[model samples]
Target: MILPCTSAAQDGWLRLRQALWPDCPEAEHLAEMAGFLREPDKYAQFVAYDEDGQAAGFAEAALRTDYVNGTETSPVAFLEGIYVAPQQRRQGWGRALVDAVTAWARTRGCRELASDALLDNVASHLMHRALGFEETERVVFFRKELS
Candidate 1:
């Protein structure tokens, strides 16, 4: 089962995020995740539970008013993070989590959903493809510190 991540769910979410992140094959930003969960408008993270009532996976999504990957205007839905346990993969848990998020987005009239993975994350890329995601564009980000 999948459910919204609330204050009560924070600890588990954080733990799962840190655990799966090694294989996440994407960006790592814990402070940002904390802020997003604490701040109302920043994000909506969710967690999935297994038959034993143990947390199995998580997904972090948000309403990005800024430009999304493929849209003209703000993104109706943006997937910041998603992770399923290696043992739990190939089951319907991840897809159920995605469905939950999309359902949440559609309620607000969201048209599209966007997510990104590192260039070399074959598993993630395959998952996206299985979910019917198409590659729109790929741009590498560069950051500089000027103080």
Candidate 2:
């Protein structure tokens, strides 16, 4: 089952997020989850649970008025992150979590939903394609330090 995240689910959500993005500090996940729980209308997080009530995956999304790649509409529903536990993948949990986000975005009057993944992440690329997202474009980013 899919459900909107609440304060009571924060700890579990944090754990799953940490597992997904292992290099990120736990504090960062906590802070970001807090923001979503505080203002659900602009930012939302949904959890997918198995029959035993364990969290299997999660999806975080937000309304982005800024330029969203491949989307012509403003105020696009942007998927910030999504992850399904390795043990729980390929069972439709990921799709269910995304569907929840899609419903939420439509209710928020959004005309588009956008998401991106690292160029080298093949799993993410295939997942997006399976979920009906078309490839927009790809470009490597560069940064230079200033004195």
Candidate 3:
């Protein structure tokens, strides 16, 4: 089953988020999760659970009024992250999570959904395609720091 992330206290959501972004500290994750939870109009997250009631995957999305690389809409729904436990992959969890995000975006009047993956993450690219996302453009961002 797929459920909306209504609380930052949901352990399953925290665990799956940590799995997807292991390098982030637990405190940082909690802080960000709290921030997201506070902004229901701008952010949405969903967690997928197996029949055994264990977290199998999760997806996070944000409504961005700022320019999103491939979308023409002003407030595009941008998928921030998604992950399915290795053992639970290919079991429809990812698709269900995206479906939840899609429904949430529509309610907010978003006309398009956009997402990105590292240039080398072929698996994510394929998954996006399978979920009905069309490739719009490829971009390489550059940054410089002045000391």
Worst 10 residues of 3 by lDDT: 8-17
Query: Each candidate's TM vs. the true structure?
Result: 0.82, 0.93, 0.97
Q: Residue 70 CA error for candidate 2 (Å)?
A: 1.4
Backbone clashes per model, in order?
0, 0, 0
Residue 87: error of model 2 in Å?
1.0
| Candidate 2 lDDT, 33-65, residue by residue in tens | 787778878998888889998889999999998
Error of 2 at 32 (Å): 1.5
Better of 1 and 2 by TM-score: 2
The regions of model 1 sitting more than 4 angstroms off are 8-11, 21-34, 37-42
Query: Which is better, 2 or 3, measured by TM-score?
Result: 3
What ranking emerges by lDDT with the best candidate at the front? 3, 2, 1
Best by lDDT: 3
Which tens-of-lDDT digit does each residue in 1-147 have in candidate 1? 887877633546877787766554324445656577686555677889898888889888888888887775555688878888778889977788888888877775678888888999998888888887787888899999999
TM-score of structure candidate 2: 0.93
Whole-structure CA lDDT of model 1: 0.78
Give the lDDT of residue 55 in candidate 1. 86
Candidate 2 minimal-lDDT segment of 10 residues: 6-15
Best by TM-score: 3
